[model samples]
Target chain A: MDEFELIKKITPSSLSHREVEIGIGDDAAVYESKAGYEEIVCVDTMVDGVHFLSSHSSPGDIGYKALAVNISDIAAMGGYPKFYLVSLAIPSGWNESAIETMYEEMNKLAKLYKMDLIGGDTVSTNGPLVITVTVIGEIEKGKVCLRSHAQPGDVVFVTGELGSSSAGLALLLEKISTKDEGLAQYLIERHKRPKPQIEAGLICSHYERVALNDISDGLANELNEIAVASRVSIDIYQNMIPKHAELHKLHTEWEKFVLFGGEDFELVGTISSQDWERFAQECADHQVSVTQIGQVSQESDIKVFLLSGQNRVPLEKKGYQHFK
Target chain B: MDEFELIKKITPSSLSHREVEIGIGDDAAVYESKAGYEEIVCVDTMVDGVHFLSSHSSPGDIGYKALAVNISDIAAMGGYPKFYLVSLAIPSGWNESAIETMYEEMNKLAKLYKMDLIGGDTVSTNGPLVITVTVIGEIEKGKVCLRSHAQPGDVVFVTGELGSSSAGLALLLEKISTKDEGLAQYLIERHKRPKPQIEAGLICSHYERVALNDISDGLANELNEIAVASRVSIDIYQNMIPKHAELHKLHTEWEKFVLFGGEDFELVGTISSQDWERFAQECADHQVSVTQIGQVSQESDIKVFLLSGQNRVPLEKKGYQHFK
Candidate 1:
């Protein structure tokens, strides 16, 4: 495919200079940096095989998910996603329509986030398709929550149940059949259009929440992240963990699916003991799912205890790695 | 061949940030978007054949250029680049050291710009190597110059001479022997390490320039851009066009090189006829190479005249196109 033409299609249509000083078609674009506000930035990449399969979703879903995952990174930092720049590398000989359809979906979703497509690049690759997005956000001064602030007694909470994306992957991989039409749709949507907890992040930005992260690497892998970053220990109770009942009933390897499979763009954050009630009230007001699954302690090792058994289990890094 | 290891090797050492709400390893990276400033954002990509020679340049040069080119775009808009995010696609068989070398160069330059390495993604590609960088900058209010403001009776000016980069590329490709050391080095530097005209842009931003664009696509192409954007006609006096005497002595096709062969990252701008003296003064103060080449008229066609033995010949598009 011709690279620039591919770009002209996927380019965000909002080229107005209202807030922008300079639009595209230049060496660089210019924007007014409001003097008093903080600037937030994040980036993400999606490979054809590692991040998605051609059989799993539509071009629109791929575009939306690429933008969403980048936004989720910003959300995890307690920021509102503002602007985005996308870069794509697709193999040559692909029909031009594939690139155009991807852009149509991406631009539509970009408008939904109220983020401008300021600038990016495009090129032809001989390998599988690769899409990368760098998203910039804005947050107030002293309001951004980081991943190293968790104290010894903070409670770990997660929004939404896990295993839906994993189930969706199984549907794509094994061609698993779902008896319920709605269940099949839910699994697919969960897998394809995993929403970033942007609003929750905005709310948590003000509170001195314990260590924070997004559930991109599954619960166990991400929990190990907080434990390492905060230099503290985590103890996740197996019974307290929230799993989709439908997923558990439909899948034989329920625990493995729930614990290790990734692509769940949920906000897994920690809050101080004093702010637990506030967090609860806020989640209730917003009608968001916030499940208390664990707590931070002074211990050196991260442990996961099963309610059905009397033993504790050490956490593992089952999160996805590019070469592994 | 392992993507993560390649990334780690290329990744620059990060700084301690109390302001980074969430650093890398999340769905998105959140930054402190300071208030009272409007944010500036831009992105650019470099494909192997279109932008560079894989055999001539190292991975480090590729990564550095990925960032530097985007920064140049922002500088052309009179903004201060502060953060950079890059996306790369490489063949799976590429060694990890190549990736590390690229990141090391990018990280070195990022520190030079005082810009943060916020976040980005990597993926395997079967096609040519590709690097895309998204850069964010800040501009104070009332300072951004745009390409749509030129009007009739505006004086057109360009920074530096034309055909340096063209000659440089020719020297590399045609394997020519040059007698002038400085000229040859100048051409090569123009090709390999283009210096963005940030100082000139800054000076012009405070003036009443009608329109401005960088000359990455040659003078005629840029003038055509001004003519189209401002809906005004431009007529460049053939004698006013700047050329290096060494180019004429060395090559028989000097006119073609000067006219259409691009890759000159100079600044082309328009000013009110009355401001010509002031423009010259600014150039002198900054020790910037600028020449008055043309003027805008009430009509909209762009014309180029030849000064050969009193014969006048209009020039054509001597610039690059997507397909070519």
Candidate 2:
């Protein structure tokens, strides 16, 4: 099919948002921004092999994960993503069905996030497939979260578990044994389809004296960021970090996964100690699992301590580095 | 440098916009949307070898053109190009100087257009360098232009000239005669550094009976798009199209460059004959060159008439298609 024909066939009619005045089929998409709110914009790119492998992931998962990662950015900022633009570059010989499936999956996630797929460009590539998604979101004025707001004596908390995604990646590469099919599948799913802590982030934003960030890199790196940006030291207990039970079953060096692996898509934040009890109660009421792992200090350095027998080592501040 | 370090170094210290509440370094950038206006979003991508070659273009032109093309989209919509997000995928072995040079060039253009380089992600690619720019613009509520709004009797107009970009590409590729060095350089600059017709589009938007589009895919393809979208036929006088005189001197197939070449970044719009005099005066006041090339007709077919001695042929509609 020609570009116009393919676009018409794939574009969903009437993306269910009154604010979206124009979606596709225009030089640019138009939308109305809600009153008394600040608009948040975030963009991310996923290149084949570097971000995902077609050999291990389905077309839908790739599409879903691409949007999901950007959503995690908005979630971290305490905003609700409302519209997105996707630029896709596909290599030759790729079947049309796969491209259609990718868009279908993105549409499903867009509806789930209450966002409209506004507009973007599609072109052919001779290299790896590249997908870039730019998300526009909004939050109530003065209610947005930032990494540079953690104060000394703030209690550090993390939502959900970490390390599973890294473990999942290892399993996919066959670097770790996959004898237990159930454990292998669980880890792989964690790596492929991550759930962004959107609700938890929104809930955390309502409280005063809180700073938030999403754990795209491992928890250690995120904590360090909060420390550096806010000019406060962070000290976390290694035993307090939540990790999937399957991670230990598959990898002996699971600590590396928990501390240095990337792509968890969980929220890490700091709340004042006085508000910890209230925050914990609210998390419980919302059915979100949040664990207080550490505390912010006046010292200008981050430290991770382990209490486990024979493994009581201070963790290094290293995380995933794309370039050497 | 690592991704984080590079981001910190490349990110501007502050963008001088009161609406920009937060710039780079956050998970997402934040800005206040002006009241009584609609936000317009556009995105475009450039791939190495497909869009331009490092051998033929400078690093700075590559960056400038990447953003320039997206600006053309906003210009077509008669919007103010205010903010932009750029996602870049750079292959290994690319030094920091080249990346910095690219950003410097983009910032120069951004300053010219009064746009802020808000936020985006960068990743290391094992493949070719890929740059995707997402532009956020604004237009007065209900004042945005559309291709489907052309009236049957409206006269078609185009800003600046066409075929220069394609002819420029031909010179760069060494496919055409290079004896005229100055002409070759001018055409190459047209290809490398296209100026988006932002002023002309904004002037045209003031009129009630006007429809607009940017000529990115040559004159013929843009005319066909307007015809199909507005459900009217377009009849054009081939001799009326504004082309670089040097293009005629370079090649025998000059008509193909004017009709089928893409990447002109000039505005194409239709204005009612009643408003033609006033519109032309306004364009002249703005120092923007515009030419009347065609008229919309009742018949549902686009025809281009070329009058030559014993040779009158209706032009075929063809443009640059990424995939055959």
Candidate 3:
């Protein structure tokens, strides 16, 4: 099929949001802004071999993950994802059905958030397939969560378990083995389809002075960013970092994955001690796991620290860094 | 350099616009929405070896054109360019300095429009380099031009000359030889840096019920889109279509380039006959060439027609379809 036909086949017949004045099949998408909301914009690109292995990932999984990662950014900002545009550079070997399946998977996730697929571009590429998704979201004028908002007395918390995605990736790449089929499948799911913590982010936005960062580049790198941006020191208890219960069964060094492996898509942030009780309760009511992992301190000499029993060691900012 | 350091190096110290509350270094960029404006969004991706040859075009040219194409989409909607995000997938062979030059070139263009560079992703890819730009612009509420707003009695108009970009590309590829060095250089610049018709678009927006479309996909294809969308027939006088004065001096079928060539990045649309005189006067004052190339007709049987003397031929939609 040609580009226009493929677009027509993939575009959803109806848009979910009234804010979208013009969807696909336009020179540009038009969105009428609301009176009291601020817009959040972010773009993320995933390449065939760099971001995902096409051999291991289904087309649906690839598409879902591409859009999910952008949504996670919106969640990190304590915003609601309302619209998205996807630009795909398809390799010649791929079939039309694969492209359609990708959009279908993306639409499935977008429907859950009431987000509209506004506009995008599709072109043939001679190299690996590249998918870039740009998401436009909104939050109340003064409610955006930023990394620089962390305060000295705030308690750092993380939503959901970390390192499972890395374990899942390791298993998929055959770098590690797990005897339990159920655990292996669960970890693989975690790697391929990460659920963005939008509900937990919304709960954080209700409270004042919450600084947020999505853990895409591992816990160490993300925490260091928060500390450096806020100009505060952070200390994390080794025992308090949340891990999947079945992750210990794997043969890999699970601690390394938790500390430095990336693509968790979980929100890590700091909140005032006074708001932690109410925030934790709200998250619990929504069935979202919330754990207090660290604390922000006034000391600026050490940007990040790991506290293991008695010894306190400075944490190195190590994660996925491109062009290293 | 790592991703973080590279981002820090490229990010502007001060944003050009106050609406951009949070720029790079965050999960997402935040923008304050204005009360009387509607947002216009568009995305375009350029892949190495497909869109342009690395040997022929500089990194600066590729970067500028990548963002320029997106800005053209915004211009087609008669919107004022505001902010943009760029996602780049760099191949292993590319150096940090080349990437910096790319951003610097893009920033120069952004400065011309007072547009701010917000947030985007940079990742290492094993395949060809890819650049995807998403532009966010705004227009007065209810003033956005569209392809579907053409009327039966409207006069068809196009801004600037056509066919120069295609001629330039041919010269770059050595498909056609040109002895005139000045004309060759001019055509090459036209192909590498086709300025978007933002001023012409803003002028069109000031008038009521103007149908606008960008000529990225050739005159025939773009006019056919307007005809189909507006459910009207269009006729273009072959002799009236504007061309560069020096374009005919080259040994090539220049008419084919004007009609079927893509990436000219000029504006083509329909305007009411009653408003054409004032619109033409305004465009002349701004030094934007507005030519009346054709007219819209009430007949819906034929979508688009090209008239030459007494003969009329149906214009085929034959401009740049991927995966043919």
Candidate 4:
């Protein structure tokens, strides 16, 4: 199918409310905020090679992931995403069904998060697919979160198991543990569909967490960012780091994958020590794992130590490097 | 200079603003709104081949156009943009100073408009250069402008000349027009730096114009949209279209460049006929040319007539095809 056919098929049944003065199929989309909350504006670019592979990722996966990543960004800021405008550049002859699938998954997620798909520009180019989705979310007055408030003595926590995306990628690339039908499908899903920790972020924000950030660049690099931004140090207990047990069955270097693997898209946020117990209960209610991996300190460097083992290593910028 | 050097040079002296909880070099730039207005959000994408070309546009031009385009989206809805988040995908090993130059132009425009550069994502990509800018604006309730509000008798007006961009492109591609260096420069500048009519949009909204839109696509196409949305028709005078004298001197063939050529980035909005004089003077005070080119009609088909030639032609759906 052609692009238009695909767009028509996948265009959501509900794309606008009275608040959306104008929707898609124009130079831009125009939306209004009836709630009167300040707009939480964000733009994310998903390019071929750097963010996703056209060969490996399906069209629905691309569409879904594009919106999913932007939603995750909104989640990181402790805001409820309200609307999205997508700017897409895809190769000519892009399949209509594939495009529909992409929008279907994207629509599913948007409905799940209560954010509206408002406006954006769409064009075709003679190059790799480039999808940029900008989402606007809202937070109660004076309730928006940031990443620079991780005070000394705050506890650093992450939601969900790390190293899954890295493990999934390794399983696909190396073929050491995958090619088996069920396992391959599982790994592929892990890499393509990122679970946004919106509920946990909202709960944390309500409790006035010290700081928060999403870990798209793996643990070490994210911690480095929080430490640098907040001017604090961390001593992460390696044994306390959560890892998917099934991943260890596929890869030998579990620690390396957990530390430097990319595309995890989990929340690696900080909270005050007093709020840790309540956060734990909230995560429990949400059925997502919450692991306290480290503590904030007034010291200098970020360090990693194994509680069970004596080995300790100072991390030097581990995780995804876009240019390198 | 390289990318790193470029970033260092254009970090913006003395910080962006106090509302930015975190600026560049973090997961995301955090913003806090203090103006107490509701949030309005929009995003735009410009690709090298689809939106521009490096041989035709430099980094600074691309950057300025990038911001201007997104701001225009906000203007379409009668909103004042406040903050922008930019994302770029440039070929690795490209000019470093070019990125810095782009940022310099962006900050200059941002400061001029009282908007802050809050956050953005940058990465090296194998594909052609892609720049996506997302803007957040604030709007008063019931004042958000839209294209669906046009009435049958509303006067259709446009700001600035129509075919300068197409005329400019023609000169560039033909190369012979370079003989007139000053004229060539004027056309090229118009093409590269098409200004967004933000202030005019605000004033029009305050006066409650019947309808509004920006002329990124050709005038014929934009009018068709307003017509379809309002379930009415527009009668435009062929002679009333404001085209540059230089463009008329340079081109002999109509070829629909004036009628269908796009990227003018000017305001193509409408108001009641009674308000035409007041609207024109209001636009004059802002130093923007506002000329009535058409009138809304109850008829369903748009009719473009040359009263002098005693000729009438139905406007065809000829303009930039999004999927093509």
Off by over 4 Å in 2: A300-316, A321-324, B300-316, B321-324
Per-residue alpha-carbon lDDT of model 4 for A101-161, expressed as tens digits? 7667788888887676766656676777788887777676566567777887888888888
Q: After superposition on all CA atoms, what RMSD does each candidate show versus the true structure?
A: 3.5, 2.3, 1.5, 3.0
Whichever of 1 and 4 has more lDDT, that candidate is 4
Worst 10-residue lDDT window for candidate 2 chain B reads B300-309
For model 1, fnat equals: 0.68
How would the docking of model 4 be graded? acceptable
Q: Per-residue lDDT for B94-173 in model 4, tens only?
A: 67778878888888888877887777777778878888888877677667667777887888888888888766766766
Give the alpha carbon lDDT tens digit for every residue of A157-263 in model 3: 99999999988998998889978899999999999999998988888888889999998989999999998889899999999999998777786477988888789
Tell me how far the alpha carbon of residue B261 in candidate 1 is from the true structure, in angstroms, after superposition: 2.1
Candidate 1, residues A1-324: lDDT per residue as tens digits?
655466556555665336665555554555654444566777777777767875567778898899888888778878787677777776665567877878778777777668877776676655667788877777776677777777778888888888788777777675466788788788878889898888888888878654678887788888777776677787777778787778777767777767777778887878898999888799879988889988887676544333335867677766754224
Residue ranges of candidate 1 with Cα displaced over 4 Å: A1-18, A21-27, A33-36, A175-182, A301-308, A321-324, B1-38, B108-112, B175-186, B249-251, B300-318, B321-324
TM-score of chain B for predicted candidate 4: 0.89
What CAPRI grade goes to candidate 3?
Answer: high
- Docking quality level of the chain pair in candidate 1: acceptable
| A26: Cα error in model 2, Å | 1.1
lDDT measured at residue A205 in model 4 versus the true structure, 0 to 100: 69
Candidate 4 achieves a global lDDT of: 0.73
Location of the lowest summed lDDT over 10 successive residues in candidate 3 chain B: B315-324
User: Which model scores highest in TM-score?
Assistant: 3
Residue B214 Cα positional deviation in candidate 4, in Å, after optimal superposition: 1.5
- A276 in model 2: Cα distance from truth in Å? 2.2
